[model samples]
Target: MADTYPWQDELWRQLAGREQHAHAYLLHGPAGIGKRAFAERLLALLLCRSPQNLEACGKCKACLLLAAGTHPDAFALEPEEADKAIKVDQVRDLVGFVTQTAQLSGRKLVLVEPVEAMNLNAANALLKSLEEPAGNTVLLLISHQPSRLLPTVKSRCVQLACPVPDEAVGLRWLAQALPGLSDEERGELLALAAGSPLSAARLQEQGVREQRALVVEGVKKLLKQQQGPSQLAEGWNAIPLLLLFNWFCEWAHLVLRYQLSKDEQGLGAADMRKVVQYLADKSEQARLLALQDWLLEQRQKVLAKGNLNRVLLLEALLVKWASLPGQG
Candidate 1:
């Protein structure tokens, strides 16, 4: 994959310019920042027979093999299913691969993406390969949440941190990626993505703005006692649990900001200003803080794969929110 975002130029140069590369590199960054794409480019460049200007020559045999997903010198390990753990058996297969000699004359490359998904056994199983890698072999691990990885695993690789790009750079890139979007829409998407251009583009593609509008509308009805918590929760079953909780968490924080600073700017969402103001005026500050804390806890639980009833959880949360005005 070519450098999809211009902000990655400096990191790409640093990786490409290195003459003596590490045996293993851990690319750690927030989600949707193109860490995997960067790793893929590095893999192709390492395996290319005739690289030019620190880039792989696309016509080379190795490049063609990589493009076709049949490269003899390359291996990629990922979860068997999305949002699932990388099993120990998968890592065991990688251990076997690393022991063998490279079929190609160049470097052998292994890529394990979102390495945090590895369970204890899977992580421990890969330790031996990392400890004593084969000659001319390179391992690249991409992790969105490095804090969750084993300390032993982290110590075995050179750490590379990818930062979120500047806001101006992110907006400019977003405009180019989504030329059809209005400036306001692009800004909203950027804010929603927390300034990650690639993520902002994805949010736009997923129509998160439209979904958020519906959610906000539902919230308004609930707050007015015109809608039941259970009914609203049932209607919102189509939205992902984590996403819905995250959105509510954001809204709660915005309400808190409005209460504290009386500054509407912290809301970030232009469309939600009126509701935010109303909530700030009607809700007790202490209770809002408690709800915010609870929402954060729930969001983290959902992300950690907690076993909870989503519909009931949502219903309970909405019930609390609907009672906020009365409590104050």
Candidate 2:
């Protein structure tokens, strides 16, 4: 059975208690907020021969088959490789599945995660199934970035906005999810994950805190001329490019915010507060804005999985960062 989160209780109630389910549902939210799990739970409940109190009965035949990954009436469509686009041929196969009669003579469920992974052709192919869904079928589409989805695709389904838990709720959940870590450590992890509890737990598992500490120390040394940009860039070869870009992007935002508001509280995480403040004080707003623009452009390339020279990119980023304190 798919495990639901405490923050999803209300949304689950609203969804599971419905008398008539939608033919297709678009569950949209930020990543790592349990939207996929929620969809899985709903799929199980819909396919179960017997459900109790708006939940799936694990003992049922359908539930057993689903648990074993042998359910004939359920289809999951995703990219073959991580971070790759869902091909048009894959969507074509799904269209064929959608038109078939359910083997169990019950409802069929189709789950597509991060629907934005489908490019224009694939998305257009999916529209065929969405337009003419056959028999008792429910399509659950999960999207972390719905703004990238086509307007026509967005219009065909019941759009459901998934909930993002507040900081206090996230921290409480993190306490249970990461008991080995102290409260302060968990708090820092949660902040690093941008307030998503599941993401925070994932970051902890990935040693993100340790990586962050290394990067912070490197940034401080770079500013003080103790470490050169090329050396720091090469030393961070093990860290993910996207993760590095995300942290730098965040720091740039914080610096600009502090420069404008002079709000010390807005300097972001404790590890980089002083660095952000120093940059804010010494860097010109125009230079910072230009750097932000460059970062955003490169970040888009990173997201698109462009063929980038990672070492060169990191070196360029660090060189630009090292120049932030002085006049442009």
Candidate 3:
């Protein structure tokens, strides 16, 4: 069974309590907020031969089949490789599946995760199935970045915006999810994950805190002239490029914010507060703004999965960052 989150209780009630289900639903939210799990739970309920209290009956034949990944009336479409586009051919296959009669004579269901992974051609192909709904077929489309989706595709489905839990709620859940970590540690993780609790848990598992500490130390050293950009860039080879970019982008934002507001409380995480303040005091706003612009441009390339020379990119970013402190 898909794990039901505490934060999703209201959303589940609203969705499951519907008298007539829509032919398609677009569940859009930030990544790691359990939208996929919510869709899975809904799919199970829709497939269950006998549901109790707006939930799937665990003992039912349909539930058993789904648990075993052998559901004849259900299909899940995703990229064959992680972070790759869902090919047009794959959508074509799904279109064929959409037209077929369900073996169980029940509602046919299809789940597509991160729907923005489909490029223009693939998305266009999916429109065929969306336009002509076959008998008792329901499609669940999940997207982390709905802005990338075609307007026509967005128009065809019932759009449900998933919620991001507040800090207190997230911390409460993190307490259970990561009992081994101290409250402060979990809080830092949550902050690092940008308030996405599941993402915080995932970052903990991925050793993101450790990587962040290393990067933080390196940044301090770079500013102090103790470490060169090339050395630090090569040393950080194990860390993910996107993660690095995100942290730098965030730090740049913090520096700018502090420079403008002089709000010490807005210095962000404790580990980098001093560094952020130092940069804010010493760096010219114009230089910081230009650096942020460059960071955003490069971040886009990172997101698009362009063929980037990671070491070179990191070196470039560090060189620019290292130059920030003495600019004023």
Candidate 4:
């Protein structure tokens, strides 16, 4: 993974200087960003008995083992089900890894992807190990929601806030990752992606790609036509609210950019220019900004409630959007 997406020079340098790194490290960022991949690079570094440089020496036997996912010194724990949780039992399992001596006899890196999945009990269980970890054992926790972590756990780790890359950088990188995508498809994929190349790759898969295109297409159609809001509301039954909120936020950004810059060469620029041009002369520009705020708040609300009725929430959002003065 590091081979494809090399660390920025600053990040690599920071990692290199940390001879006595924290026992627990937090890699937090927006969902679908490359936290897991970055964590893997760090894991490879920690486990590498001998490295050629700051990066994992790809030729080393340890690197080969890490790539094969059978590195005895490395352990990764993720949620059992999608968006469910890491239970207490999962943390206890880490206890097992920590108590045992490193199979590699050098260093061990335990990666907990989406550490926010840990329920209260699970977090507490891990806290014990973090407080008194075995020598040479390091805990690397990746999360989309940093605030969800317990304050105690938060204080223990050396935190890395992974900033989302610029949209152009992310899109260009992703366009180069996939081999057979068309220009339109690549641009659309970047538009739908959440600034995460990992997520962007997943969006390239046939089913996911089609769904995202449809979602964006739906938004375009509705926002472009009078009473379009009503049409948008019609499809809310099958859409997830969390996803809808995200889509709306992205759309607003596109519209705002397009309107402000009048650029049509790319996905966001073109779309945003169209929306901005349409509404810039209107008295309701302020209302549109308000709508953007509402969408952002809605996204936060949906994420906060793990059990929200996503479909209903989307429909309600559409209704509100349609009722707005600027909606054509």
Q: In candidate 4, which residue ranges exceed 4 Å CA deviation?
A: 1-4, 31-33, 55-68, 163-172, 182-188, 206-213, 216-240, 251-269, 272-294, 326-328
Which 10-residue window in model 2 sums to the lowest lDDT? 319-328
Q: Clashes in model 3: which pairs?
A: none
Q: What lDDT does the true structure give each of the candidates?
A: 0.86, 0.92, 0.93, 0.71
Off by over 4 Å in 2: none
Q: What is the TM-score of each candidate against the true structure?
A: 0.93, 0.97, 0.97, 0.76
For 102-171, candidate 1 gives per-residue lDDT tens digits of: 9975579999988988989999999988988876889999998898899999999999998688888888
With candidate 4 superimposed using the best TM-score fit, by how many Å does residue 13's alpha carbon deviate from the native? 3.5
Point out the higher-scoring one by lDDT: 1 or 4: 1
Q: Write the per-residue lDDT of candidate 3 for residues 1-328, one digit (tens) a residue.
A: 8998988999999999987998999999988889999999999999999999999998888999999999999999999999888999999989988989988836899999879999899999999788677888999999998988999999999999999999999999999999999999999998998889999999999999999999999999999899998999999999999999999999999999999999999999999999999999999899999999999999988887789999999999999998897721
Q: What is the lDDT of candidate 4?
A: 0.71
Q: Is candidate 2 or candidate 3 better by lDDT?
A: 3
List the candidates ranked by lDDT, beginning with the highest.
3, 2, 1, 4
Better of 1 and 4 by TM-score: 1
Model 2 C-alpha RMSD to native: 1.3
Clash counts per candidate, in order, are: 0, 0, 0, 8
TM-score, prediction 2: 0.97
Flag the better candidate by TM-score, 1 or 2.
2
Model 2 Cα lDDT, one tens digit per residue, 29-95: 9888899999999999999999999999999899999999999999999999998989999999899
- Give per-residue lDDT, candidate 4, residue 95: 86
